[model samples]
Target: MRPGPSHLDTARAEIIVAEAGHRAAVDYVSRFGKWDARASVRQRPGRRLSGHRDELATPFPPELAPVAAHALVAGRGPDAVREVLTHSLYQYLHFTTELEELAVIPVVAKISRNRSGLDLPEAMRADAFKIYTDEAWHAQFSYDLVRQVERASGIAVRLPELPSFVERLDAVRASLDPAVRGLEALMFSIVSETLISSILADIPHDSRLPKAVRELVRDHAEDEGRHHAYFRQVLHAFWPALSARERRAVGPLLPQVVLAFLEPDYRAIGTALSAAGLAPDEVAQVMAESLPRRRVVDEVAGSAGSAVRYFTEVGALDDPATAEAFEASGLLLGAAR
Candidate 1:
């Protein structure tokens, strides 16, 4: 049956209305904290930790070497401002999606307990809760940061009006055959969590950003360590269940996913450099030099360090495949070293 244009528009309007309501609820909960104000209160001030500046001593590899150079050569001013805006827009959308998804974790955790024998350890459970809490904080932080940047620079950074991540998530959720659940866990852990940690960690400590932005990144990095651990544990638990066919299917997908996620940062950087008034050649140089170093910082600050520690603790590094994959992916490749 052919629907009238008005009818289709009405349906889309309804969807938009429903999504807006969901987003409002998410924003309210994440920004203002839980309905019970007492529960949402911060007990202690979040500590600001400095990133390892010495880590830059390591030389960037061929793969990431260019980005670092590009950033260094990029001019400052409108181009740099635009770069920041572009990057912030991407982050705003990414974190907002995470904030919305993590908001539902409590419900998912409850369901896992009731329907599946997915018994999470007490520590792991706490970590999961902390992740949700941290994600909410990150959402608020990103939004506020964007707004601040817009006000300060007069660059209008656009936020996503719709939840585009839901399509990807819904696809994963629909394929919830228990046999594939571990793959799903790994998908979120490695692809989403690990990638994000690396990028956040890469953000220069001395970047001309506000103090609040730096602090938020630092706090989020600490929490991501725990989140990475939880996902690793889930992956370890599900390891034996994966058949050869499944492993083969999953192996190739990881790089693709990782590359897709990282691509946005590159685009943002380019836009920012251009907007900041850097010549194309200069932008290219800074990206070549700085981006790789940033990748190294991200790996160390987030999951790669924890994953290596986990491997050592559990004696899993003995597995040739695991060790090889880690090295090939540049997980253990420290900056230039």
Candidate 2:
């Protein structure tokens, strides 16, 4: 049968209506449905201080916590931002890839449990999916930024693969048994999100990086705020069930892992700086002084601030020993100011 113009117009009109309805539905879901419960849920408790203080104050081998508190404080005024941006862009690419790979863990676990009749909330599921998507986007964004920097400055910044932090996290998760996945989830969510968020906030808005890079980082910081909320909720919700030993294990590991991520591979930095027209010795001086300050700024602004808040919320920072440790670690010195 040959369709007339009227019939074709009718079909087109129906398609348009359907598309509009779909768009409206998506907007409503995003704006209202997902956020309805947020107001009722109080912000998660802050990190506990007593145990954390001891862990931070404890003497460790040089490699374990390489950069000292004094070093970070002393290095602040130099051209630290330039060095950090170059190094961090490289680090972000590596970490973003790891984040994507880790997304599979929750997906598989959720699906398996669903088959057995346990179901996670649709909103939670949606948020998880969004994280997976964000991770990939962030990776590409960082790669693009790195490429642009190279193009603009005629520099080559090559980053090696990060050893699988996510895999190690999963192994830690597995060792604890399924009953304690919430703790592992808490550790992952709080530590990882807070760390990166703090760092992003610390980057000088007036830095030499292009507007595009700044916008990308700003957007990432917003997304991380939501992620931090989710983890804080999870931690508070599950705190009563966690054992003393489990809590203790988490305290030390948080700072250790956070510090581990801070260690700048100077060789990589040297390569990037040399490509940017600096001599090797010049790069070395910049790194030895500036890199540590940048690391402190990144850590404090992103994750450490949230961690401190969390501890305060949870009443863990009450002990004198914990307070001393925090002081010694110098994580809190002039950070909020």
Candidate 3:
């Protein structure tokens, strides 16, 4: 994690290879990008939903909805499942759109404009603009689908104005030195893009889910594959440029950023459960039973495996302090080093 002339020298070697990789990153936004031909926003109305399931049919998987599982176990019927599914869709949409607009887009814009202080090639900067457009389109389609679902399902959305990640991120920033806030934000975006999202990975392939849900998520998942690669490369390019002082200041905070982004918003979940007719005590029990502390830790660690590996490859975790931070955070307990 030491940043210095020697580090910069190593970064130079990596940058040469990274430059070739960026050249391979096509301008997806212009060529085959969803914005041109395959974007959800461009699909004809008739092509939107599968005929197999009506729009009001289940919008999300029951297994993915912890509250829905609790309701069923308690003998609540189809109505409860519907409520949970509707709320789940709303939560997913709100989180996706808000996270993109608030957290990811700003960092990407920085890279595109060469404000990130990384020595990436022109192709990489050009790709950043493509990513920005991709993300904006993602947010737009997410918002659009949520409103469409509301109309079709006759359910109103109940969600926090900002995703819970934003609140946790604010706390993390407030605890950091003012000078490193920008660096922390950059690392946060890198971790977020590189981490595998269960929703994006699993939703599109679940045939039991509605067609629109699968298609919408599939489009997003495809786009994210590119985003993931770009950010991983970004990390490769950015880490070696950090000064030892900057690394020490910012490195250990990586695991905290992972947690901030991945941790479930239990408060919002509880509120949704209550709105779906669960009593206060029932919502408490449901949340406790469904998202036990150990389970949460394991999930975060598992999901962050790839992102952690990126740090390890770039020597961030080689810093004893950074390793200790990750270990203490429980995000590296069983992860392969």
**TM-score for each predicted model, relative to the true structure:** 0.52, 0.55, 0.85
lDDT of candidates 1 onward, in order: 0.43, 0.44, 0.74
- Candidate 3 Cα errors over 4 Å, as ranges: 1-47, 50-53, 71-74
State the lDDT of candidate 3 residue by residue for 114-160, as single tens digits.
67766555566676887898888888888888887877777778877
- For 179-221, candidate 2 gives per-residue lDDT tens digits of 4345555456445654544335643263443445455666566
Give me candidate 1's TM-score against the actual structure: 0.52
**Residue 229 shift from truth in candidate 3, angstroms:** 0.6
Question: How far is 143's C-alpha from truth in model 3 (Å)?
Answer: 0.4
Sort all candidates by lDDT, best to worst.
Answer: 3, 2, 1
Model 1 lDDT tens row, 1-337 = 0101111221121111221121100000121223133222143244232333322122112122234234343335334433444444445445554533543354335423422123333333343455556556656655555555555545565434433344444555455555545444435444455334443565426354445455555655665554554455544433333444444445433433343333335555565555556678877776665655566445443444444454334334345565565556655543223
| Backbone Cα, N, C clashes tallied per candidate | 33, 16, 2
As a whole number from 0 to 100, the lDDT of residue 77 in candidate 3 is 70
Error of 1 at 298 (Å): 11
Cα misplacement distance, residue 322 of candidate 3 (Å): 1.2
Decoy 3 TM-score against native? 0.85
TM-score of 2: 0.55
Error of 1 at 9 (Å): 53
